[model samples]
Target: MKNILKYMSLAFVGGIIFASCEKSRPVVYTGENFVAFEDTLLSIPESSAKEDANGETQAIPSIATIRINRGSGDISKDLVVSYSVKAKYVTTDTLGNEVILGDVPEGNFYLSSPGAVTIKAGEGFAFITVTVVDNDQTDGNKKLTFTIESTSDASFTIGYPGPDKKAKSMVLYIEDDDCPLDINDFVGTLKVEDVAIVSTPLEHSYLVTSTQVSPNSISILGLFDPVTRYPSPTPCPAPVVLVFNTATKDVIFSPTTQTAYYRSGGCPATTNPRVVYPDPAVPNKFNTCQKLFTLNYYVRNPSASGPFDFVYSTVSKP
Candidate 1:
């Protein structure tokens, strides 16, 4: 009787250890990329792009999305299942800032809902995972909304099948949208006075060389001339030095930043003219346009982040 009792205790301890190891088993969800492996953060072109004068509204990609994998590890018959998805971006910046990279959306993707994993009654661990979207819609009221959601849930192991290998299949699933934005009805007479720096291949895009600031939407200054001296060399009516916030889209006539104020100056007269600052989007690099400003421009963005910068988009008086 003593021997039997000792043997039973040993079996119990062994069973407990096995159970603990079993609980810590990793669920391998085999997944693939949309096009390339690096496509984890795949970028789409502009949902809507318009050609100038003769230009028409054309399509450009601009959505980013992904899929999840659920493997049928050594299982036979399909097992009942549910799954949850989680995803993240590679960069520290929030998902949308016009200049910052964008996010993935489900509206234009073909991610399926989760279902069951198949396995025999004696079979163990068969998982099926599908699609999840982490969408950061670029720019929203100057604040970005980075969201990720799952179309499924994780599953529980039912039983175990005889040891055998299995494989699962996956495919790309993203489609372009017809009208993601209000680019259809809201047409403003934008005097695309100037197209400033959008890309600088050889420099950091966050520094401004020289910034001029004053009051009254000073962010619209587009002068290609030099600031004059006062006293003996004073220019007529004293030119109002214009200033702008290349970041934050802030503008002020008196040196405030990112506020949209009606430009109040022009070249020569320098009054009531739009102001364009040195390109802060790219530092240590010079843009072809020495001057940048828009006239008769109308922007339909409910928020102020949207600026009109089409080249020759509007007829210029000068």
Candidate 2:
């Protein structure tokens, strides 16, 4: 009887092992493999195209990329992905806010050629060029939607449901050039934390003002004495001129401008003889909305060199 019981126990263990192996078997997709956009979303910046010497806008097209992976089988041939543009993907609510629930009417604000993209054999990626045309409309609510429908091969599927809906589909917003500039967004008091003047260290705070010099330029002013929080005694120096690239949020300091002023005083009463933007200063950071900005620079002169950091906080403008 004991021998019989042992045999039964062994049979039960073997059955359990067999069940687990069957359940854990890898799922093999016999259909054609698939491809998706490299990124879930693409944001085309405002003023994406540059103007030529004649002031005519250059033709600039936004590009979206697609990629695929080799499953158990190698891709022996090219895989072509066909896509379409539709207006039924999103809509705006009564409040003018974007609601991604329903679709809108079809339009020609965006155009794409060859509606299909091909992922070459042995290669995993391809790009689609999308051109955006200005409609001369001031409305800030323009958008374009693209969807991947089917592929040349049968085994692949379009986009996955939920979480990944953006991967197989995308919405592009066309920024309005006539939108009002948010001037107060970058005007505030910044703490000039550190000044490396040769050997003497000077720390102070100053107020900065922003003036829109052009569609893509801003003049920075109101830089005052850090200690007194007043205008620098030297009135002969000029304010720094910055070219703000709205698309990239990059502030480029014009080389022709002088950021630091020379002070005339006593021992070198020469208390603070020189203040200049260090060439090694780190790049500044700005937000997409231009509401806030961070300024970073190294201060150096014949006397000392060190980092100066400032963070722009929101303040009410008079």
Candidate 3:
């Protein structure tokens, strides 16, 4: 009787362990269902570049990626999705910003394949290509919009709408390539007039000879030609480099260090001269015709604790 009781207890413990193991096992679903991987559907911007010389717009390629999620493991079935768009897909907001159907210009943008895209078995995503045309038109902003219509898989859904409407439709804005202000456009000799140094205005004349150092930058030479005859007899000349921003005809000056020298009797010695500093507060400005640029920010004389009240402007530029 004792042996039978012990055997019965062992059997009960084994059964309990087996039942717990069974309950912890994961359940697998054999049915197939697909969903969009992204909360929103959108395409990357395809840009049309303008010609270097004539500013003519050129056709460029833009691509948008569409990904799908299959609940079931890789299957031997092809998932096909159809996309459609109409004129109503394109609209402008109160701010004049336009949102168009497709990728910038769905109907107008050139495409190799127009309609349906397929997601092959074992693959969960596909790419959609949109053609961007540069017609040299700068009238206003343009756009293209693309939306998923129907899928071949009955259990598959197009998109999941989230807080942002981007999940349902993809909109691409076609930016205009309009740049009237470039470094080359403003290259020439700029005269410096009404010069002031260290709070004392003086009748001094200087010229800033601007030469194109690069496509986007210009080298401004002869900044200290009519050197300020201040506490020193000889002042060192320093050239400043400037970069041109097209959107705003703004010329940004690069920070540089200049040396202020005093004549040492006859032949100049190899010793280093006094240092001239750039003002931390002042920044140069430029526009279409009327422009204000800093040749040298804060120029200090030898033995002076602070910078001289220095200001220079472009008298003329061609």
TM-score of each: 0.25, 0.37, 0.36
Q: Poorest 10 consecutive residues of model 2 by lDDT?
A: 1-10
* Winner on lDDT (1 vs 3): 3
Q: Candidate 1 — worst ten consecutive residues by lDDT sum?
A: 1-10
User: Per-residue CA lDDT of candidate 1, range 1-318, in tens?
Assistant: 000000000000010012334567744433221111112233333243456566666444333333222234323333333332222122324465333334434222222233332333333322222222222232221111211222122332211211321111222222222222221111222112223222321111111112223221222222221121112222222222333333322222343122222233432453332333223333221111222322222221223465433111221122
Report the lDDT of model 2 for residue 263: 44
> Which lDDT value does model 2 have at 10?
9
Better of 1 and 3 by TM-score: 3
In model 2, which runs have C-alpha deviations exceeding 4 angstroms? 1-32, 49-72, 88-104, 108-114, 160-166, 180-318
C-alpha lDDT of candidate 2 relative to the true structure: 0.46
Question: What's the ranking of the predictions by lDDT, best on top?
Answer: 3, 2, 1
Candidates in order have lDDT scores of: 0.25, 0.46, 0.47
How would the candidate models be sorted by TM-score, starting from the highest?
2, 3, 1
Residue-level lDDT of model 3, residues 89-207, one tens digit each, is 23346486655343333324333223666666655555444444433222334434456677787776456534442344565444444323445545787766546654456556555
Question: Which whole-number lDDT from 0 to 100 does residue 121 have in model 1?
Answer: 36
Model 1 residue runs over 4 Å out of place are: 1-61, 65-237, 246-250, 255-291, 295-318
Give one clash count per candidate, in the order shown: 64, 12, 12
Best candidate, lDDT:
3
CA lDDT of 24 in candidate 2? Answer: 68
Off by over 4 Å in 3: 1-178, 197-199, 203-205, 225-236, 245-250, 256-280, 288-296, 301-304
Q: What TM-score number comes out for model 1?
A: 0.25
